[model samples]
Target: MRLDDLPLPDTPAARAALEVARRFHSPAFVNHGVRSYLWAAAAARSEGLAVDDELLFVSAALHDLGLEPAFDSHTLPFEEAGGLVAWVFAAGAGWTEERRDRAAAIIVAHMADAVDPAVDAEGYLLEIATALDISGRNPEAWDAEFRAEVLEAYPRLDLVGEFTGCIVDQAERKPGSTAAAAVAAGLPARLAANPLQL
Candidate 1:
């Protein structure tokens, strides 16, 4: 489905999160964020899972906030920093403490190897969505037409190259970081394993 045609939550909190993410992240990261949400939402629907749209939208929109130079923290891994940023944004948007925490948790867990849907539905969906975008896992889950439309709406802008570079930079700058671990575990191999044909 086209990005424009996809259903996005129109709540005030969702809008605020998107604005903050767009303001902080680069164009490429912003597109990645949006695609993450679209893919996650579609996956959720396919699985017949009930999702909190506002939480999912906020979590997905701000998932990469740490990649933004303004928010990048030398002390924390990008995932953790992004989660903190999302938590703060959600709190400021008048989200309840529980909701804010949930959003933060979802962002923090996106980097995990697996997210158990029974434990955290939003996180599981986000994980799958990001996996699909970054690693092309379950490419069959999204048909050719849907993939084509998403790409047409939000051109890649060399996402694999740019994102890989970002992760490598993080690894070099913060050896103790999750990005560093990913690099140590063979990021190049992972990227090759999940090639984006487009």
Candidate 2:
């Protein structure tokens, strides 16, 4: 699906989340967030999995929010910090406690290497979308034309380099954090394996 054709939530919560993300994140990061949601939706359709668009959009939009200097935590991993910020935003947007908690789960789970659809469809979709965007993993799931359309709409802005740098910084600053673990686990090799050339 083209970026414009993807199913995006038009609810107040979604709009507020988008606005906040745009205001706080850099243009490249915001673009990446938008593409992540679109890709997640496309992946959900391809897999015949049901997803909550609002929850998924919110999760995807704010998944990397902790990378923003303002929200960066001294100890928490970016994923956890981002999830906390998202939970607060969701609650303020009048989401039920249950919904807000679920959103937090979705945001945090996106960092996992694998997500079980049976556990949380939104999280699973976000994982697939994020992996696709960051590393170009699972390229075959999306047709070349569709991928090109998404890239045209939201350019990469050298996201691989930018994101990797962010993780490297986090690793250096927070030795026991998830980013540090990712670095220790050979993040460079993973990025080399999945190149986003579109």
Candidate 3:
């Protein structure tokens, strides 16, 4: 699906999520998420992952929303992105505490290379987001040099099953079985869905 084809929220919560995302994301990253989501949806459809287009679109759009205030520069390799933009965005989207927190975990734990276990629902989405992020060019406002420097911080990633599952779960109407399980069962699907041709 194209960016215009991706789901746009009619609800206040989803709208808020978009507003929150616009603050920190460069147009390129934002565009990448749309393309990635479309690819991810296609992968899920082919794999029988049973995820919906809206959930997939919304989740992908907000996946990186958790970048911290410090995200402005590449001084820090990665920040606690899980909660950075997620907390506020989820709230705008009117997600449940459980759901919002689960979303937050993805933002905070997004740094795949830095994460100890490096396998969880949130981390899984982050991995896909990051891969797709650097794969394309970012907007000038984001600073090309800073984006490249930050991209270098992430080394070869070792994906966990649980992380990938989160994408599946979120795409599904079930919205992932308690965040923890998202990565557990969704990794293979997530890895398969990655459109970077990795």
Candidate 4:
């Protein structure tokens, strides 16, 4: 798989979602979001998953929106808050009610331990893609050349330091959150040891 081989959805909703990611997230996060879409599309190709490109792209672009201060929730986990944001965005994009629910579900499932592709292909793809981006989990899942291309194009910047702080803050503030469990299970160390080498 190569960078050019990956599908980049160019729908109005997809473009607007990417713009929202750029407007709200830091550059590192924006890059991560974009990279996540590429990775997901690559995985879909490899696994023969027939995902809706526009839906996957939109979900990927806004998956981390709750981490932004403007959308951060005091009582809910970041993923949940981000899902609400996506739900609203989907409505504004003129998606059907069911489609809006699917978008929100995909955003929330990215933080889940796993998602069944048979049930939700988009969610499954987003989960694996985000895991790859954040922790370099299963780098073998993607072509090495493609991985290098994404890194070269996006540049990791200070993602490790920045994301570590974000998750840590979420953990401290919401002890029952998935972020808290991840932190308790040595997420920081895992992030530091990520094999991406970017």
List model 3 lDDT by residue over 1-198, tens digit each. Answer: 223332444656555555655666655445544544544443344334554344445566666442323332222222244354555566666677877666656554543433332345334544444544432212232334433433333222332233343344333433322233433544445445543324
The parts of candidate 2 lying over 4 Å away from their true place are 189-194
Overall local distance difference test of candidate 3: 0.44
Clashing pairs in 4: none
Q: Show model 1 residue runs off by greater than 4 Å.
A: 1-5, 189-197
- All candidates' lDDT scores? 0.84, 0.86, 0.44, 0.92
Error of 1 at 2 (Å): 6.9
Q: Give the residue spans of candidate 4 off by over 4 A.
A: none
lDDT of 4 at 93: 94
lDDT of 2 by residue, 40-146 (tens): 99988888999888889999888998988999998899899999999999889988999989988998898888989998999999988888877667888897898
TM-score of each: 0.91, 0.93, 0.47, 0.98
Better of 1 and 4 by lDDT: 4
lDDT, candidate 1, 61-106, per-residue tens = 9998887788899899999999998889888998889988998899
Question: Candidate 3: worst 10 consecutive residues by lDDT?
Answer: 70-79
Model 4 lDDT on a 0 to 1 scale: 0.92
Error of 1 at 20 (Å): 1.5
Candidate 3 residues lying further than 4 Å off, grouped into runs, are 1-10, 52-56, 65-79, 108-110, 113-126, 129-198
Candidate 1 vs 2: which has more lDDT: 2
Please tell me which model should have the higher TM-score, number 3 or number 4: 4
All candidates: CA RMSD (Å): 1.9, 1.6, 13.7, 0.9
